[model samples]
Target: MRTIRVIGIGTGDPEQLTLQAVRALSEVDAVFVLDKGSEKADLVALRREICARHAKAGLRFVVAGDPERERRPADYAGTVEAWHAARASLLEALIADELGAGEVGAFLVWGDPALYDSTLRILERITARGRLAFACEVVPGISSVQVLAARHRIPLNRIGAPVHITTGRRLAAGLDPEADSTVVMLDADPRFDHLDPELTIYWGAYLGTRDEILRSGRLGTVGPEIRRVRAEARARHGWIMDTYLLRKPGAE
Candidate 1:
């Protein structure tokens, strides 16, 4: 049976890859890539650089066009389900056509696959269809959440306190009062803009790369600065990937 390794490539920094992840990359016969477009071409190029550094020479890269989906839809969950289905179909064909018997294929995912990434889920969908016969393996890597805390010199959770990880959409609805510390990911908008002034925020963008940006302070005082800087960085780079930590004072 063909094997598919869902290797977590961490963020952009190639040095962030664990020895185990590097070993996995070196073994794979082919790596699958999705073309996200010109604006995010740097992301694809970064993946190629990583493969060049770690994988065996002459490793094949199978690139496919990423399916388009609505950025904002009335039914967000439904839209995402459809999008995943499309991706599963695309990847299934790649696996069937490109992967030979007993050969290894890989998807170099950003951060940890167990996090917000959809590659694993898409693979599962293809497997559930029973058309593809491949074994799946996951190699973990450093996540941006860890990098954020380290860069900011702050613990993700207060002493003996729990940390809640959520998205920007849920953050806008409201935070759970009991949440001592919250980590927000995949937030394009500044949902923390209207939050309590006393809350502290540690925000980072383009994490683990040379273009990394970090900001932290009371929400009220630094909120505007974050907004302005985030906009300028996005405009300059044509894309942005960010995550943040929000904590209540004396939550512990």
Candidate 2:
């Protein structure tokens, strides 16, 4: 039987690769990479760099075009399901063609695979189909959330209070006013503006890289700046991955 190791390569920094991840990379016969097009070519380049540094000699790469996802579909859940199905089909084909029995293959995921990434879910779908025969092992890596907290020099939770982690859409709908601290990820819009103006925000972009940007202040005063900076960064890089922490005053 073949094995697929889903290794988290951390954020943009090549040094974020864990020792275990390096071992996994060295053992893999092939690494499966998803090409997100030229707009995000830098991302693909980073993955290539990781393979170049850690993968064993003669290791091959199976690059597959990522399935396009609907940005604003009315049926968001249905659209995502369809997209995952398509990705599963693509991965299944790649594994069957590229991986031989007893050989190891890997997918270098950004951040922890158990986080927001869909690689593990897609792989589960492929396994459920029973057409592919491969065992999977996940090696956790530092997530952007951890990096954000570390860079900001703040704890994610407030004392014994719980921390709520959510996305922009959920944030726009609204968050619990009494909630201790809320961490927002995948927010392309300024949803934080709707929250309490007195709330504090710690924002970071392009984390773990030379282009990193950080901002922290009262939401009312810093919210607009975050929106502006985030927009300019996106325009400059053609892509951006940002996460922010919103905390109520005196919560800590």
Q: What C-alpha lDDT, on a 0 to 100 scale, does residue 142 get in candidate 2? A: 85
Residues 1-41, candidate 2, lDDT per residue (tens digit)?
Answer: 99999999988899999999998889999999999998898
Q: Against the hidden reference, what TM-scores do the models get?
A: 0.98, 0.97
Q: Estimate the Cα RMSD of every predicted model relative to the unseen true structure.
A: 1.0, 1.0
What is the C-alpha local distance difference test score of candidate 1?
0.92
lDDT of 2: 0.90
How do the residues 85-176 of candidate 1 rate in per-residue lDDT, one tens digit apiece?
A: 99999999999999999999999999999999999999999999998899999999889999999999877887888899999888988887
